[model samples]
Target: MTASKTLNVGDKAPDFHLPDAEGRMISLSDYRGVPVVVYFYPKDDTPGCTAEACAFRDQYEDFKQVGAEVIGISSDAPDRHARFAGKHRLPFVLLSDQDGAVRKAYGVAATFGILPGRVTFVIDRDGVIGHIFSSQFRATRHVSEAIDVLGRLA
Candidate 1:
């Protein structure tokens, strides 16, 4: 399910407070003053989601080198996120959007009938969205798109 409004480049990325894999509440406001790559995927351990996540994990250090943060969000519960992150050894944060309020706020819609949409937003240090990438099939492209935005921002 998506919202009536879809966020666009230069719009302020919507703020959200969701739980991470460890049940720790994390808010977008907390990452203020840093560029953030926020990605929304369908599920925890699915094929495409896993590929997208691992791609982010692989490039995590490069993001850090440029002073950016990476976060992944899904409707899965905290425990499921924990297991998925542990199994994949994902170094970045994975937040549980259990009620999917965050996804709705970001206007990430359902794709291919029921699968949740795959979207990535690169928010600059000022909190304005610098880039938006949406592709349900080409999952890994989200990471590269965000990285390119952050690279330019850096």
Candidate 2:
């Protein structure tokens, strides 16, 4: 696999289309003119992933209040995503990056070249990346970091 260049603040957020939990296509471009929080996680139902997802779900209203959308991406299949979301009552979108293409495009490195990396990107309404937070272990912090950035973007 080709190594994806690490993206940074001020870079243009890469556009992507992936299936949501329901097998419907969702595109980054579809949220144009609206800020978006895109988070990459390792898997669904795992402890760390679940904590990160639920953290986002709990703060989902704050994101929406700021006119931002929260989206979670993982390599899991759509069916798994559906079950995970339903189980946790996640209020945001969970996308299936079955082939890891979108994750690579975002340049989310795997932790120690093994587990999938945990990273969060905040994209402005114009589609420019405004902030990026990467932490392999501190999952819940991703939500607060994204919210803090969005608050500043307001």
Candidate 3:
């Protein structure tokens, strides 16, 4: 399949329908009319991924206050996502991208052509991307960057 161009700020965020931790179908359209933070991580329960997930968990209230939804997506199975979320007490949704199709649709590239890319997209209420941050190592910063952009949108 041909690769789509990487999405950028001002572009329309691609709409997707995926299953969450409990196997409940969740669509990006389900969250329209409110800002959304969609982060694609490498995997569930890995050291860096855990740190990033926990960072979002800690500031989940801040995101909620602004009426923004935070979603973490990885190729991990729904069961592992459920475990990861439960173990960290995460209050946000974690979606499973089993085939990495959504990842490619969003143009979340791999690091060194191997590992899944750690990228975060901040979409405004109108479903337009407001900001995009990608960093493989500084995973926690994705949460901060997303929150910062969401604040500006608010």
- lDDT per residue, candidate 3, 1-154, as tens digits? 2355778899988888899999999999999899999999999889999999999999999999999999999999999999999999999999998988899989999999999999999999999999999999999999889888888888
In model 3, pairs of residues that clash are: none
lDDT of 2 by residue, 1-154 (tens): 3448889999999999999989999999999999999999999999999999999998899999999999999999999999999999998989999899899989999999999999999999999999999998999999999999999999
lDDT of 2: 0.94
The C-alpha local distance difference test score for the whole of candidate 3 amounts to 0.92
Candidate 1 residues lying further than 4 Å off, grouped into runs, are 1-4
Better of 1 and 2 by TM-score: 2
Whole-model alpha-carbon lDDT for candidate 1: 0.91
Sorting all predicted structures by TM-score, with the top scorer first, yields 2, 3, 1
In order of listing, the candidates' clash counts read 0, 0, 0
Q: Which stretches of candidate 3 lie over 4 Å from their true place?
A: 1-3
After superposing all C-alphas onto the true structure, candidate 2 shows an RMSD in angstroms of 1.4
Q: Of the candidates shown, which would achieve the greatest lDDT relative to the real structure? A: 2
Query: Which window of ten consecutive residues has the lowest lDDT sum in model 3?
Result: 1-10
Off by over 4 Å in 2: 1-3
